[model samples]
Target: MLFAVEVAIALFVRDRFVRPYLGDVLAVVLVYCGLRAVLPLRVLPAAVLAFAIGALIEFGQAVNLLDLIGLRGNPVIAVVLGGSFEWLDFVAYAAGALLALAAERFIHR
Candidate 1:
């Protein structure tokens, strides 16, 4: 599934473009989908929740919570929690959520 591919690229892909940006973009989509799977949120709410969660994670990175919790040394935790903060990643998450919302609207219309 798309989530699996995104996870693989996010973790394994070392290319500058795909690894840095695309992974962030797809992360919101994955988060949105996961939220929808458990919560009965509409597209907009799901996307919003995804963006909020992504922002929170970015904030966590800003504070070095991963390092505080000893997750920084683990590759999987490093990839999932992110090692450093980037403003661009917030933009990517918003863009990805917007795209997902638009697609959902188009499909459900």
Candidate 2:
């Protein structure tokens, strides 16, 4: 499952590309799939929501949200919220959204 893969990447991988970019891409997909599993979400909306969530988190990182909330020192929060911001993350999120849309179309056809 995508969650398992995300966990594995988070726990084990330290590469420059896979851990960051690929993980981000899969993250959006995971979010989309998760939303679909629980809610009556359409594919495009789910993907958009997923990308929005990730982008919001990334913007949070840009503003150092965890530190402002006094949670930067918390390891769990640090991991979940992340610490750095990158424009490429937006690209990865978009890619993930498109990939999720494509996969949904492929699966339903």
Which lDDT tens digits does candidate 2 get at residues 4-108? 998898889999999899999998999999999999988888999999999999999999899899998987678777889999999999999999999989999
Error of 1 at 64 (Å): 0.8
Query: Where does candidate 1 clash, by residue pair?
Result: none
Per-residue alpha-carbon lDDT of candidate 1 for residues 24-76, written as tens digits (9 for 90 to 100): 88888889989999998987889999999999999999999997897788988
Candidate number achieving the greatest TM-score relative to the actual structure:
2
Q: Residue 51 of model 1: what lDDT?
A: 94
RMSD of 2: 0.9
**Per-prediction TM-score, please?**
0.92, 0.95
The list of candidate 1 runs beyond 4 A from truth reads none
Our model 1 lands, by Cα RMSD against the true structure, at: 1.2
List candidate 2 stretches off by more than 4 Å.
none
User: Native-vs-model 2 lDDT?
Assistant: 0.92
The predictions' CA RMSDs to the true structure, in order, are 1.2, 0.9
Q: How does model 2 score by TM-score?
A: 0.95
